[model samples]
Target: MYPASYYYRRRLPGRSRGKGLIICLIVFLMFSTGIGLLKLINIQQAIPKFPLLILGQKGENALNLMCSAMPLLPVSIELNDESNNQSSIQLADILVLRLSRVFRLDRQSPIALLEKELPVPVEVESSAVPVMKAAPVLPNPPSPEPEEPRQAQVPTLSEECLMAVYNTHTGETYALTDGMDRLQGKKGGVVQAAAALEEELEKKLGIRVARSDAINDDVYQYSYAKSKAVLEKLLAENSQIVAAFDVHRDAGKSREESIVNIDGEILAPILIIVGSDARAEFPGWQNNYQFAKKLASEINKQYPGLCLGVMVKDGRYNQFLHPRALLLEIGSVSNSTEEAVQSARLLGKVLGPLIREIYENKQSE
Candidate 1:
């Protein structure tokens, strides 16, 4: 023990120097850590927050600050109370918090801190993120022109007058010309005679004739009734029809009674029949008789003795429908079809002139 003061002084210098070095090192370390933390905070504050672009319904206006780095996303942020600026800020904060959670940000991130402080539930859907494309601008379209009104068309009446010819007993056929019976089938001798008359009236006399090829009734008993309907239809359709003739061949009558000869050519005699049955709805039978008389007289003047005179009967025969209605028996069943055809042609020649005269008289009246 050389002295207690000497040992104490020697140990004290070393210990004091060691303690001072440790304290200075601790202070320096704390100061450096604090300075580094402050620098990090400043850098974070300096970096700009990503601006969210909100598009309006029309897509012609923007709702937030424009940022070049931030990618555009089609997000519908329906802030019904958008007039309040506080609600808008709260929504932005919520969006940032969701982004921070999705990107797995650092625990000390400002966005993450905000997420913890927010009162609303933070449900981030990582799958439903929509990428938005900028809308294209279009030019205005041109207006349309007005259309014109259309005109209506009118129907014109024929220059030449028309005549209607039809067969009452359409099934009355010929014997030798059209094989088999004369009282059955449509291809009858009377039909052929009427067609020849129609052709002569049209081609030779320049008359417009409408002849019906309709088989009125298959059964001969109901022929007159059925033919009346056909005649009515013809007269209704053609207002120009001046006369209607029902051509037929007399059955079971003598050949001498029905045949005639004109200029060395054998002919079928034409008989003009006038219906005079006042009780059968024919009050205008006298007018029909007068027409028959005139027509018969004309036929006789043209071919001398071709007509066998007029016969007054007691049946309507649809003569009441028109004053010029005539039931003409061309020939008997025994007479040949060639004779009947010749008679029909001769009739057309005389009848065409008579019809023109009657029409002219009516027009003059």
Candidate 2:
């Protein structure tokens, strides 16, 4: 073994070194733990407070604050004075106190400062709220007026017979089954043609017409006298008859003289003959001639070449009875009765307005 003092000295050095190392290690550990604890505290302080969700009820004036992240804790704030003995406080005042405590806001904050600066409430007696009145309804606008009915454009003549139509020669017939000239007892085609003309004047034109059904062929040589008697009877019965027609058939040898084409419709030519007896008896022959010329002009205007011009003859032809009387000869013996009937219809159309004019003139007179 070495000397005793030397050995003790070596042991003491090792012990001191060990003690210093342990003390240094302990101090470092304490310092690190303190830094760790400080960091943890800083992290906790950095987190924001939970937001409050306020729910309120009307009339009761109560508020509930809800927290989404944490369970809500009940908080009571005294806003009314305890000494005044008031049991309930205004909800607006309670909200101010709760917000101040939860947000840790001071009097300098806007909400807290505004609450302190606002004046106290005053009590007033309540009355019933007035109801809003509805606006008055206006009456409906007037309906537009109904239009007046239109008047007919055609002239309206008297309902009584304004004209008379009679056949002088009842022996006249047509090519439709009946030969051209069938004397005595036969209802001649000229009668049929006259009847068609009568129908158009009375029914279509609203003119009253007097038609003679007499067969004057019993005295063919004295046909004019017999027809004159028939016309006088008609005129006697109807004083309103202002005009008369002695309808006859011509004795033409060819169809060219009697057949006329009007708007593609084949019709017999119409010949109006005015008689001038110039004798002292028939003084109104000039007036009859004037009327026939006017009527022929009108017919020609409606149907070109329909009237083969008016014939002025020396014989009286019984036209002296009426100022408007005339002898109308339809298509010749060569022309069909159908053609004559068609021509008669067109003649009635032209005569209707003419007769109306004459009737009106008589009224004015």
All candidates' TM-scores? 0.55, 0.56
Q: Model 1: per-residue lDDT, tens digit, 1-365?
A: 75899988877898688767755653443232322222222323322332223223321232121111112311222222335445444444444444445455553574343234333234457667786877887777766666676533322223544677889988675554665446465657888888988887777777778788788758778888889889998888888888898888777766576678899887999898889875577778999899899989989998999999999988878888888888988887778789899999999999988877777777889
Error of 1 at 7 (Å): 99
lDDT of 2 by residue, 1-365 (tens): 98999998877898688767755643443232322222222322212221112212331111121111112112122322344222222332343354455445562344333223223222234555566789899999999999998755444478678989999888787654376466576568899899989988887888989998788887679888898899899999998887999888888458677689999998999999889865546788999989889988999999999999899988898888888899999888888889999999999999998888888888999
- Stretches of candidate 1 above 4 Å error? 1-161, 179-183
TM-score of 2: 0.56
Compute the lDDT for candidate 1. 0.69
Deviation in angstroms for 283 in model 2? 1.7
In model 2, the worst 10-residue window by lDDT is 61-70
lDDT of each: 0.69, 0.71
